[model samples]
Target: MSGALLEAKGLCKRYGALVANDNISLTVAPGELHAIIGPNGAGKTTLIGQLTGQIRPDEGRILFRSEDITDRGMPARVQFGLSRSFQISSIFPSFNAECNVALPIQAKAGHSFRFWTPAVVIESLRGPARELLGRVGLGERGATRASVMAHGERRQLEVAMALASQPSLLLLDEPMAGLGAGESARMVAFLKSLKGRFGILLVEHDMNAVFALADRISVLASGRVIVSGTPEEIRSSREVREVYLGEEFDA
Candidate 1:
């Protein structure tokens, strides 16, 4: 929090006549986890798209580590250490876990398309990949096929792959989606351990995970930020209760 790691100011995005984001603004600090939560069609993912440069904002600016990135494309932003995951599962189904993790490092190591040589042969990639896998608690499972691993391990593998990029900021779009109780719990624990290392912007539907991990919560409704507050404030907020969280609980 000493210096804001990411800053989105007055971000506005529109599609035809529809306003997807309305003057949204927020900041992420180093090693802090911030969450964006909302129901379907509420523009949570749209906001994420704007934040990570997947979608450009009609107005407003994005700054990462003090650099203005308002117009930078996805690849440029990612190269500057902004990493993200999708709502759906993201992995190399055919690649083993280590290979999957190593690929990102290979890309960063400047040998991404060296198909003539084995990827693992590049020590720059393999060493970092193995270390990242170990950091995420997948130390022994690196050799397993990604598809053959359990659902939770696959998710973990995705995380390892993301980390392999050496990102300073991580944008997670529902990493816990489709996970059962045990898998979800493990994912939560894994996420908790990642705090204070990277500025993480987490988009998740699981309230339990959000509450447990978020240092701050921003609630969106109909493409606008309705509320932003700490977990206790969010849990006790009448606006949050009346709008979405309460409904999620009742259902």
Candidate 2:
């Protein structure tokens, strides 16, 4: 834990009598890929919300890079090098990929997007935006409008935007969601390339992707961690198989 880049301790969120996340605790070591997996209503999103500071937990604490950030807001957390991508695409449909990525870089540099001409299209930010796009495998697609790109490309763009903040930890909420077989494979390869570059907390339903990318995985069920271990350990666990993986999950 001393070397952990991110840590969640006893995270709990309740909606009246229904507990969304109950006593959840997990850690992401520096440059480690930690995957969170579970079925429907497993509170994965709620936990992610708390981690990203979009939602406050009823009881819990979050540490980022050895700093306590339980009460921090989204902007404050971003300042501390924590960034995230949403489950749904949160890109600018009308703008091109470069501009979408530039927006975050501009904001992080203490510039406002009030003036469309200057703030939105800064010559300086353009370089970094394109660099981020390249990191996410969208180097040549920077000129493409986000609205016209395929879903997989849009997802990649979202990640490029997330990286604009230069985060030490990236919380990815289902980056592989809504992709075809080929697209999914491409995403898996992209994520594999990012494995040791930064700490990644992945919340995904794709077992193959999870198994391929995670250094360790935490399986959630009924608002609690059913088990946490290496991917091979999780794949071989009887409890995890019965609760989430199922007998048919070869991964």
Candidate 3:
């Protein structure tokens, strides 16, 4: 509560008899990387959906930078420095990587309607887009078609697009969804490098990557948060093992 950049208090959502999120509460401080992990159907993604305005909670409050955003739509949230990426690729695959990156910058700059004009001529949007691609280690691939780039690099482009708005907080839903071994390693390295630059709400299943990157880990089971602790504590938690990992998770 001291300096929370994003806070979800008493969040609850029900789909018929299935409770996807039940009174879930969490706080992410400025520039902290917070990860949420759990077994399938544990409501990790549901909570993320509610937090990002994809879905509404039956009851709760969502505060961003001390402002209430529970009623805010996705675009409004983006305007307020809140950005998110989905588990699947959401970029314009037909466009060049940099073009996809630049679109968001243009959108954020209130120029999406002027399709006939050249966005590159506008320095306000173009400059930040280039810088974002460079920051994500894709400076040289700016002209590459997004559909032709490697999967790992496309994911990096997705990140670049997210950063186009200069978000203060990022809600990443399974950033490593279909990455291979080497690609996953590369993603892990990149996220570790991004550790302190922005507050992140990471929902992932890769425990190896989670331990390597998260400042704190929150575990959930059956639509409820089991516990939240440091990597060391989570690694040794008997309850987590028995509930999610079938008694052999940590053995």
Candidate 4:
């Protein structure tokens, strides 16, 4: 845990009388994919909000690269190589896939977006944008408008934009949400290929994808982490099965 890419300790969030997150803690090691899974309203999203600086925890500490970031804002966190993709795809609908990605690259390069220079003319931003798109399996769709791309492709583009920040740890929220079987499979394969390149904290409801991609998993129930362990340990956990995985899971 000394060199953990991201660490959260005793995070607690409250909405008046309701407890959203209760002493939630987890760590993502460099190049490790850690999955967080639980039923709805288990405080997974609240926990992610705290980690991403969108929501302040009433009690907790967040550290990125061994530096305390609990007080840091979203931009500060991104500057520290922490990036995230939301469960809902956010992209520039009117812009081509390349331009959408280029904006973030441009921002990271300290360039003004107000400049009239066309994205195609700015080879510096365009070059890396294309590569990031390629990494997300959207190479051929770079010229396609984001609005026209399928839901899965838009998800990929959003991921490409996150990569534009060159994050050391990427937090993904429900990457498989709203995908059909084929699209889900594609996303699974894409995520599988990213193993060991960077640290990833994934919050997903897709059990198949979670088991396939996670090096370790943390199960949340009623705003608390019920278990945290390797995939095999989680699979063999009777409590996890009973609380979430259901009776069909062979203990």
Compute each candidate's TM-score over C-alphas: 0.90, 0.93, 0.92, 0.93
Two-way TM-score contest, 2 vs 3, winner: 2
Clashes of 3: 0
**What TM value does model 3 have?**
0.92
Residue 156 alpha-carbon offset, candidate 2, angstroms: 0.5
Residue 80 CA displacement from its true place in model 1, Å? 1.1
Per-residue C-alpha lDDT of model 4 across residues 1-251, encoded as one tens digit per residue: 48899999999999999999999989999999999998889999999899999999999999998999999999889889998885344587898999999887877766454565664447767788989999999999989998899988888888899889998889999999998999899999988888899899999988899999999999999899999999999998988978864434442
Clashes of 2: 0
Give all candidates' CA lDDT scores: 0.83, 0.89, 0.85, 0.89
Best-to-worst ranking by TM-score: 2, 4, 3, 1
Query: For model 2, what is the alpha-carbon lDDT of residue 196?
Result: 95
Candidate 2 structure quality by residue, lDDT tens digits, 106-205: 8787645555677445887899999999988899999999889998889888888888888889999988889999999998998898789889999999
Cα error, residue 9 of model 1, in Å, equals: 1.1
Question: Which run of 10 residues does model 1 get worst, by summed lDDT?
Answer: 111-120
Comparing 3 and 4 by lDDT, which wins? 4
TM-score, cand. 1 vs. native: 0.90
Cα error of candidate 1 at position 146, Å: 1.9
